[model samples]
Target: MEVIAIQKSTLEGMKNELKELLELTENATQKYAPIFKEEKWLDNQEVCLMMNITKRTLQTYKDKGLLPYSRLNRKNYYKLSDVQALLKAGQPYKSNEDGVIDQ
Candidate 1:
């Protein structure tokens, strides 16, 4: 392991930097927590597991506009509330005996 020394002058600067970093983190947490706390977004695997469906079936739902999602960085995210609403509303996607909807 390598050890580094900070002078007294640098110590105060480092403390100030740390404080600013923490403040920025706090501000971000305060701003973003509530926006996302209520509704969590699920990825493809999560959605499939939650709905007891396969990835292809999930894709079929997306294709048919039965499921809603937002794409970010080429990844799809589905809102928890939307998924719950779909389950509560009824079968969002039709499935055969194998539990996979025929596309």
Candidate 2:
């Protein structure tokens, strides 16, 4: 009877430990699910559409070192954030309400 009681207690302890481990794994997945979302790189054609410019003009910026991009497997790919930064930098702002004075 004593040995049986000890074996039962040991089994209960292992069950409790496994339950705790499963709960911890569930919590971690809930916390980091978004971080694992798929990311698709935007290409030059898509970037030109987003930036509202002609392909020739965008190519000029790429050649001039004003924009940063990556060439992947013989094709150009731009991070959307980096493209947004380039567009923001190139935007013509009406400084002092003078309306796009070429300073």
Candidate 3:
């Protein structure tokens, strides 16, 4: 291995700069900490129950791009915020010939 030497003053300056950079990063992280809070996730069953919809309907929503989800371990997970936003959007349902609302 080749031996390289850095001046003591240069090393000290590098350390100081690194320390300052770390402090700035930490401060920025803390400043926006609330925005990065852990997101609440809901599984398929929970989402269906909360939205009062069937699993097939939930699948339909996903297919229609009305709701976004992540699948892991062969299970689907959804963001609570996205579900709430869909609810707030008040997506209308279709009516059947018998005057029954079809969701």
Which residue pairs collide, candidate 3?
Answer: none
Off by over 4 Å in 3: 1-37, 92-103
State candidate 3's TM-score.
Answer: 0.55
Better of 1 and 3 by TM-score: 1
The estimated TM-scores of all candidates read: 0.64, 0.48, 0.55
Model 1 over residues 27-53: C-alpha lDDT tens digits? 999998896788899999998888877
Ranking by lDDT: 1, 3, 2
- Comparing candidate 2 with candidate 3, which one achieves the higher TM-score? 3
Candidate lDDT values, in order: 0.85, 0.71, 0.82
Global fold similarity of model 2 (TM-score): 0.48
lDDT against true structure, model 3:
0.82
What tens-digit string does per-residue lDDT give for candidate 3 at 36-90?
4767889999987887776767777888899999876998889899999988997
